[model samples]
Target: MSVRQAQGPAGRGTRPGLWREGLAALRSGDLRLIWLAQVVSQLGDGVFTLGIVVLTVELTASGLALSGTLMAQLLPYALLGAPAGALADRWNRRLTMVASDIARGLVVALLPLLHLTGWLHAWMIPVVAFLLTTGGLFFDPAKNALVPTVTPAGALVRVNALLAGTRQVLFIAAPALGGVLAAAFGTMTLFWIDAASFFLSAAILARMRVSGRVPALTPGPPSPRPSATPLPQGGRGAGGEGSPVRGHLLRDVQEGLRYVWRVPVLRLMVIVGTFINFILSPLPVILPLLFLTVLGLGTAAFGTALSFIFAGFLLGVAFVGVSGSRIHLGYLTTAAMAVAGLAVLALGAGPPLTVIHLIGLAGGAAVGIMEVAETTVLQRESTDAVRGRVFALYESVSQGGRAVSVALAGALSDRVGLRAMVYAVGALTLACAVLLALSPPVRRLARG
Candidate 1:
């Protein structure tokens, strides 16, 4: 199907009514099921993250080992995200997501078993982390690609915002809850809960009816070979014959790349996302280290700071959910990016714990605005057929940027001091925002 046809009433050309139409789709049962599943799964993920980290620490005291475990969880996105995204486009998104949930559940279940049997070595953390993350590589892209299919185009911003808000809520509540659960019931119990959540998510998703409309690729003209079969009935081609399928997978990938490159707004958005992630990724990796080494804080203090960040994110998401669609998103994005940079700078400057928490909150809020706006822009601009591929590239850039940031942050903190590293990253992020503001495409988008 052509882009125009696929977009139908939901296309950009539609006026204010399109938004209402989108909202109607979101209110449907299928979409609600997906949203609910996402919430449950994300809550589980939040708890699992805290529980696993604490579990690893209990087994070993080395900071590097903990970092290594984190790295293992992240590496799958860097390595397999593109291919997994392609697979998501090829297969049933619902099935892909269901399978991912099942796989993750099994992985989490193994953690507790490993602990109970005294077989939980430091190396085991990375191995399990990698396996669980590999499932995420499939799950995320599938969920993203499935959204436009189930929800209305006009309602996308609101739906995205709502989902983002839920995720932020999970971030806020999960760590603290996980910490509490670990203290009261043990880390192994948290893993079991995490495993159960995934199964529950899968069960919910399995019942949703998602009749996704697959985009039909243009076929190539038929050849004159004697054995060449006539074009399938009603298949359109040049000269009224079935057009040969001109694009290979590699070619399709290239087409998606070109599409992003040619669209000035998309290009600018991708660049901003890449840079922001580069600056932000280091925060989580280094924050714990800074708390321990520089601030002389314990795990609980670090958790408190992290919670403050989540609090900021919740506030930001709420603000955006209320006002984002009405605002000129481009300007919001630029301003948020700059504010985030400043927040990070403040974080690194050795403020008191209270001040630090405030900075974290502010930074998280800025990130929330950026994420909601950026994702909405992408959804609005792209066609459904190529959306998966485009998002794949987006995910790849995000993952790669983050990985680089993590590695660089760890190195810089060790060599130049955490304060200098944080300030440098912050300044660089500020530069990126300035560059984004100056770009004509980004400026135009902001105005829109």
Candidate 2:
């Protein structure tokens, strides 16, 4: 029997209809493994981020130097993301993910070695950051592409909610623990912990079994494969030549870009996401200065502010989970982005800590809502064959926009003051949200 046939009714014996389908997908072993791996990786990533920043500051005490390190970490995604996406489409996603984990683990493990030898310098930090993120360039596309393949069609929203919720948890817990670890064992020890976490993640991933084997591209018809049950209506892997594909890497990159541009709703999403990133990019760079210099707070206080934002994020995630199928997602997305922008503006208005935390909470909630909605939209809209490449381009553009925004923020904040910069970014974000809401294509896609 065909794989689809053997599996019986597509979503049979599932809970009630759409909601049940989504829940079952979330509960699937494949998606569960992916979620588990991501949770582990994100937590480790938080620790690594804290450790790196603390270590860099200890070594160089220069804000410019730290900014440069962050820039280095982000630049690779901007530079290499398209090619990474194409490669992901052509490769076995499981292998791609595992290799990424292993690569990150090895790179992080070398940090202590460099530190012990006194070879770690402020300049070297950027290079290491680049290498680390380069691995992510490969990992992210593969992972995003894999999600739709494993889940039931109706379950995309719920799975996305679960993913968003886990990320919220990581945001809340990881940095706090990272701070404590950095204070106690030092930053180098945190790197060791990060490395171990990567290995653990890879081990977990090794056990997952993705349904469709990504076929090696050649000059002929795609290899025939064993069938699972026929997927549901609007099921994935339905179109295309299904042929062994071959093309120039650059051409593949161009093809991916063209594919994204051709889709009107996806294009709108890219634009909106770009604007949001532009608005938020300054927070990480300028917020520390604000807290330390303007608010007269210590590192611990700054961490507290971050925690407030994360707390809001957790609440938003929960909200998304509970209302995944019931809400008008597009409207929610528009509202969330607007609220996030406004909250950022409020954050800069010099309110008391209680007020600041409230603003942070609001902004975090907005971010959580926006992310889950956005991811679900993308998963539903894209074809599996092209999904990785498209997401790669998405990530690359988002990171590139963020880099530009960071640069702009730094320059603008330096000249006009941080408060003005915050207010300006907030205005731009709100404008983008309005634009997205007005776009007919975006509204239609959200309803779908």
- Kindly report which residue stretches of model 2 are placed more than 4 angstroms away from their true locations once superposed: 1-23, 116-122, 215-243, 288-305, 348-355
lDDT of each: 0.75, 0.77
Candidate 2 deviation (Cα RMSD):
6.0
Model 1 clash pairs? 1-216, 219-243, 219-244, 220-243, 220-244, 220-245, 221-243, 221-244, 330-446, 331-446
What's the lDDT of the predicted structure labeled candidate 1?
0.75
Show the lowest summed lDDT stretch of 10 residues, model 1.
Answer: 221-230
- Which candidate comes out best when scored by TM-score? 2
Candidate 2 TM-score over all chains jointly: 0.84
Local accuracy of candidate 1 as per-residue lDDT tens digits, 166-195: 887887788788889888988888899899
Q: Write the per-residue lDDT of candidate 2 for residues 222-315, one digit (tens) a residue.
A: 2222111111222223334343355678877876677577667677777778767767888888999888877776788788889888888878
